[model samples]
Target chain A: MEYETPLFFHVMRYAVRADRDVIDMVSGNPDWEPPEALREGLREYADLESSEFQYPPSDGLLELREEIAARRGVDRDQVVVTNGAGEANYLAMARALERDRGSEVLLTDPVYPYYPGKTTLLGGSQRFVAAGEDGQLDPERVREAASTDTSCLVVNTPNNPTGAVYPEETMRELVAVAEEYDAILLSDEVYDHYDLSGTFASALGVESENRIVTDSVSKTLAITGFRVGYAVFPHDLAEEAKSRHMLINVAGSRPAQYAVLDALRETDPAYHEANRELLAERVETFTGALEAAGAEYTRPDGAFYVMARFEGYPGTLENVEALIDDIGVAGMPGEAFGDSRSDWLRFALVTPRVEEAAERLAERFG
Target chain B: MEYETPLFFHVMRYAVRADRDVIDMVSGNPDWEPPEALREGLREYADLESSEFQYPPSDGLLELREEIAARRGVDRDQVVVTNGAGEANYLAMARALERDRGSEVLLTDPVYPYYPGKTTLLGGSQRFVAAGEDGQLDPERVREAASTDTSCLVVNTPNNPTGAVYPEETMRELVAVAEEYDAILLSDEVYDHYDLSGTFASALGVESENRIVTDSVSKTLAITGFRVGYAVFPHDLAEEAKSRHMLINVAGSRPAQYAVLDALRETDPAYHEANRELLAERVETFTGALEAAGAEYTRPDGAFYVMARFEGYPGTLENVEALIDDIGVAGMPGEAFGDSRSDWLRFALVTPRVEEAAERLAERFG
Candidate 1:
């Protein structure tokens, strides 16, 4: 019941410490400036009165929660500001299992690794339903995999590793599946702002008491280290989630939340659009190189990752290491995601060296 | 079972939103200036390069952990920088419970309410052992209350409600009891810096594999909102705790850690000494008023709280509310802690209004 693999940071650290020149495509930390107002907020916080440095409300700062609620079109009481989307998902999943409906958690194959790790940590059994090759999860497939014993079905849109944006109909059917099974639909939309398809739909859009949409300013504002994120829960679940959040971390960093609130209030939407365009360009460059290398790859619809499969190069720890040592480019081994994507490698196109890493992969694999 | 009482914030908020001129003695937030270097660190962080805003090492910033390790005399690997001592305690308790030895968690009565709340959240059954009237836990009492079925024993010192600082002999015997039961001892020493008594000892000094020390900069630096804390574990427990922390929170706030680390390195011991001296004065003033009022009370050995029992005025929610409404003062109801201290009210002396609050109580009750 332990995590089957070391976390992404392990591989990332190895790549980072390698003596050879390595272009990191392994980590998801965005290589872009955060909203200017975030830094401005930090500077301003330094001058605040001493009491301001004391604990914020255990749930979160009222203004930050209010902002998140307003932006997501949910009641302020429904939002539980978490340490990050990491804790948001954790709380959502924990609450789901706490309901006594079921202990079985439904996840996607080629999934975000943290989901399963969290399931094990929370003492829930995990069952993975494989998504299609295009990283698309068929609602029927999920429905078939779930049961009354399934406590929750977790999905990420504008997703990680595969970067598939679930469409409105798919989201609706998924919600229906959850409703039918009496399971919570825990939707992680941390990458919502990075949608390139212009069709990303939130589980929030599909109204249901069972839906919990978890998001963070980490990706949108390029401040993962800030650790300010929240979950929008059904009213029944919000109080418990906030209480759990309080017991877990007391609350997130107040200065971080303050900075994020300031940034949220002042930053223009154009800033997000500009970052999306930058990712779009990087995606094109990286995928074109995959094509030139004659490798099959998923052209991501959103987020900034591309999964590529090279012939005779089944993704494995050895191969991942060889790529790092020999070609000087680092990517996550597909096997790390789950068995379904075991033959592919996932590259995060978040670094400025995306084009350079693409060229290295093209030359080596071709 | 659910938490028996609402969290401290609920009461704090009630007092905050109260229309009366209540002198707040309920919340433990320190009313003092944090080291100036902390603010300087935040200002400097606002200008750091973009990559610095990405995730620090998931456990924590290496520099911060290293600083903590050096100061605490533990190996760097033994430290897992957490969201606060809150999460540090959570991970330590979780790891102890996960050992599969038992599910019963031993806690002190008149406990910090959050301890029992956390035990419940973690799905462990809780058993409370009452301390002496003076707020001192007799190790023999804890040994008598515990069994082989106990997974962990949690203690806070310089305690929250009672403010008892365990002497070395007590801590050593407590460690022995934990060893005998094959249970982990989770020590929350967030108030270590607030210790006014020269005799205050850390469980870390007791030296047992069963011991895990949880601490935070929140109380020490008077920056609870910074949310930077850590756990020091035996080597065997460190990796799993770090992994759990990563899943719970990708990492704590980098800027917060940076600021704390700066303050840790730059702030003089005299600053802490000054704060302690200030608290010592406040404690004397508050206790004199309690004596004048002819109320029974515990003179705290360390930390900044006083538990007082007024004649014909048992600590209850209604009584606490009446205090806020009629006497224009707020102190936490003793019933909120546990069964043993139900007749007493706990006042946090960490406020500038201690003199005013003391006068109000003396005039009304004397």
Candidate 2:
């Protein structure tokens, strides 16, 4: 398989060392304070006994997994803490493929590149079904695309690049399709807390053994550096995922998990509410600037990204670099995601300078 | 592949909540203080700016990589920091299989179970070459066992379950066999710091493009929960490994890496030397007790594990549990390693109560 490294880091690196100033809308690293509790937790961890510095339970610290399970309405046995949602997704996909129902992974076009990338890495064939223009996947289209050969279906809600939160009905229908095709529905809800529309539905709510949900506090808790995430599998599949996780990572960072657990317990709902409000405002400002530039764009309903199209400029790597060099604005080339969005540029509004980047884009493209 | 979960955790968990005071020789968790500098680093991290808590460079923190490169005598670009030595070894194995030389992996019998577990996880076939009774691999046997079908040779110096530090000449011959067979040589030298014998040889010392060495401070620093480790690849293989690392895990825990980097720079060699001395003392004491029990045991030349065969007691799941229940001591069943040593049991002498556990075993089995 070709090693198609994700381009987020590549573009971010280019923007970083560029001679001119570049507003980084390229990567998803959050530009906000993590929960105060998280820092406090880390400080507390430093004083932990020597044995506490050894490995946590291979699945995770039992307390954290129990907390995650309690919140997600699952048993603790169903949760396997992972390095991040990246590994969570990888484990979910591996479990799906390992079921031997099929070797083809069904993904959406204009997908999170890592989804297709991981499928290929795990030696599974990929089949893409394009999402609608507003970035919502149609269950009918997915059903049509899937067959007995479809081992898994990967969907990211409050999705990346194109932030569409699937409705509860869509999630149910997707689960039905997965059930009918004997395929696992792997839902990545890492952007769960970024649901500006409040219409986001979790696969965990779907009553199907065929569904697995992967999530992380990376975005929610604003602790991407902590590298803590988890997957909720059906009880039967949990053992294999845990085994895979143990073999792959042994365990997540105990300090990170401890911190995340403390944050989860101590941080108020207002913390999440405030971040959502902040992202909601950024979306309004950024999309309004796109309107000023007379560029076509999809204003995100969820997550912290906006996809825009300029009149004559296609979102190629060359165009992305040109914008970085010329306009001092950096965004991901949509073609890097998949062919469907080849003419669009996706910007992560994760920086405090989102408005400034929007102004830069409007002034130049306008 | 039947999800053969590594038995270490299963046995450890059994002992943890067992009805008695079981001495935990089952797991390799070191019972020692991590460097004071590491705790200081975590406290320092809690005070860093918010952006500093964001995702680190996918490969690793630059200073950490540079520090590792300088110490290991490899180019900075040749190193990829991983979740732990576990992920480092995973990445190396993935790269070797991706090279498509062959799908078969050559491993040592009486092996670290994770090596074969990883081989199966990666969809590769495994072939084992038995080690000598002293728990050391004969390079001639390795060369005789390897074929063009073998894509990689995974060896651990100061190895797990059996502490066999490869001599410089043995490492040279293993590299030669890998080079001759067009196989990648993946040497896991995680126990480099615990080399009780002065003759421990690193694959990095061999100038072969086929060589990849994986190491971590989990044992040396007694901070397994930090989950920071790295792999040094041949310059040509670095990119693919990095890409795989990124996809499998977006990044390692930034705080853990930051803290580890601090400890690496600030902690004196005395910390490591002191640890080695402690383990050497534990080995002498534990083995002496084993001798009193009239058991045939391999005295480790390096690493912390001791394998012993008790007369009339074949190492098996039931026997391991019986030993734990009756004698209140825990050790891994040798059959968990491979058929080559099914009659033996492996004990990790990493706890303060090693002497007590050793006494219990001697009294019961003698």
Candidate 3:
């Protein structure tokens, strides 16, 4: 196994230096604070005696699973809490691919990088289906890419980098394709709550036996450091996913799960709506600036990112590095997302200083 | 690509709830409270801003790694925090086997079940060296097991189930074998602090580059639920372990790491000593009761477990299940540990109800 370093995070580390006044528009970390209720839940649970800190039930705490199921409108048995959305994705892929030798995975071009990284590492090949010019995943392309060798299709709705939330029609079509091909659909909805368009489509309700939904509170509840995430599987795959999840990390942190339970139980819908509005404001301000700077870009429907192509600058790896070191503005090279055209860069909208980042980009490329 | 269910833990779960009033002496869980300082640290960290709850550094938080290094008496760069000792073991095995395709892992008979479980799952074969009647590992046996195919040796000091603390001289000899064979020594010292006879030994001080130590606060600090463990590896293997750790589960929980850090820094030595004394008392009482009931057992030098053999009863899977279902006392079947020809069952002595448990066993068997 030739292990590849997580280069995107590595770049983020380099860009977040103390001396550099860089405007970090890298990594999909939410800029807003977690809801007060959620934070208090964590605080309250943390203060409890250490006895409460023992190993969580291998499947997950019943309360947490029940809350997640209720929120997703699924059965509690369908959910398996994992280390994070990363582990959930890995488990879903492992469950789907391990059974079939020479299985290829279908991933949308410019998809979340981990889909390919994990697939390749797990002895599975990948087929990249290019997204359309509007920065939205094309169901027809995905259908065409499906073949006998493809065992899994990974779809990240409210997708990272492009923030293209799949509409219900698109999701239904994709789910239908997966059902037709008997391929497992691994849907990553980590950014589900960050949908600025408020039209988030869930793969869970897609009436397909092949769907596995991976999600986390990292983006929604802002508890990424807590490392609590989950997967909801069809009845057929739940046991295998549960077993693999136990093998992966035994269980995630106990206090984190308890906190998640409390948060889901107590958090107000107003908090989520307010956060979405804030992110929408940032996107507007930033995209307006990009237009002024004459950059070709697609405004995200959800998630906190924009895929912008600098007209004069063909965004190569060298250019990406130079922007971080020389220009002091950190963004992901689009090439990292997929083997698509490398002329685009991804700027994260989930930064506190979005206005300043826009100003910096304008200063350099206006 | 055929995946087997995790056998050891799966069996343990069955044995846990099989009987009413089952005295669980099977699993290696310590029945003690986490240090007050560690709990307080978690409380303090839980109240931190949501940004503090964002994704942790992939390798680990620097301060926690530094604390681990200082505790292990090694440089900070050598340590990488992991999900738990389980993940540490898995990561080390994966790294070792990944480096060499035909690599074989060596373990001792009556070993920690995870060694075999993880090795086999990671695409590596394992060879077991039998332990002496005294439950002590022989360095000569380890040397005999080493061959050109051997890639790593998994050793647990203050060994799990058996509780045989390997002497420094034996470790030195094993270290010599590791150096001569150019094989990595993956030492599990999760039970380091629970050494009853004050004879705990570590491979960290061994003058060998081919050594990795897997340990955690689960056993030492009595917070198994926290899932905070680490692997201290030679510089050559550090990067691989770190990368795998991140890919496997990103990192352990942030607040848990902070709690462990505080436990290491602020907790008094007396707190640890008190935990040790309590465990020691339980072991002594439990073993005495077993002996009076005509059960033959090895007195553990350290850790919270004792492997006992009943005179007439062979510790098969069926008998272990009967003990749980009929006698309401759960002890791990010796078969789960290894293929050794002994009627041995494991007893965890960390429970607060040790005296009552002993009396119950005495009444049943005496």
Which of the numbered candidates is closest to the native, going by highest DockQ?
Answer: 2
Which 10-residue window of candidate 3 chain A scores lowest in summed lDDT? A1-10
**Native A-B contacts reproduced, model 3:** 0.58
**lDDT at B247, model 2:** 86
Q: What lDDT does candidate 1 reach at residue B350?
A: 76
**In candidate 3, which residue pairs clash?**
A54-B225, A55-B225, B22-B328
**Residue B88, model 1: Cα distance from true site in angstroms:** 1.1
Worst 10 contiguous positions by lDDT, candidate 1 chain A: A1-10
TM-score of chain A for the candidates in order shown: 0.98, 0.99, 0.96
Give me the runs in candidate 3 sitting further than 4 Å from their true place.
Answer: A325-327, B1-19
Report the lDDT tens digits of candidate 1 across residue range B88-190: 9989989998888899999998898888888888889999898988888999999998898999999998998898998988899999999998899998998
Clashing residue pairs in candidate 2 are none
Model 1 residue B151 lDDT? 95
Tens-place lDDT per residue, model 2, B206-307, is 999989999998987899889999999999999888888988898999999999999999999998899999999999999999999999999999988999
**For candidate 2, what's the TM-score of chain A, rounded to 2 decimals?**
0.99
Q: Residue B252's C-alpha lDDT in candidate 2?
A: 94
State the interface C-alpha RMSD of candidate 1: 1.4
Candidate 3: what lDDT?
0.80
